[model samples]
Target: MSRVCELTGKGPMSGNTISHANNKTRRRFLPNLNEVTLMSDALGQSFKLRISAAALRSVDHRGGLDGYLAKAKDDELSSNALKIKKEIAKAQAAA
Candidate 1:
């Protein structure tokens, strides 16, 4: 799997590593990602997603997986996450 956050779309960023001699070297700054299992009450299932720490915090702030998916921008989410978002929406509409 790619090093990308499923929820926040955080990915590896390129930057320069500067030395004390003012020499610069190419480097990659990777996002702080963790594999987390989030449960969906509506679907009665759990999803394992590789998400950034920031995204995880935001999900908690939003009140859980459902709330985060409901409020997240579709463009920002991964294809898998987008599918879950659609399902959540359908479940909510039905409820």
Candidate 2:
């Protein structure tokens, strides 16, 4: 799988590593991604996703997976996450 967050779309960045002698070397700054299985109350199921640490914290801050998916922007989420967001919205609308 790619090094990208499923929810937040966080990806690796390119940068230079400087040494004491002012030598620069190209390096990739990878996001802190974790494969997590989060339970969705609205869907009544648990799904596995590869998300960044920051996204994980934001999900917790937003009050769980459902809340995060509902509030997150479409551009910030992966295709699968967008689908989940739609499901959550539909479930909410029907309730």
Off by over 4 Å in 2: none
Winner by TM-score: 2
- State the TM-score for model 1: 0.95
What does candidate 2's lDDT look like per residue over 1-95, in tens digits? 89999998889999999999999999999999999999899879888999998899999999999999988999989999998889888988898
lDDT of each prediction vs. the true structure? 0.94, 0.91
Task: After the best TM-score superposition of candidate 1, give how far the Cα of residue 59 lies from its true spot, in angstroms.
Answer: 0.4
lDDT of 1 at 83: 95
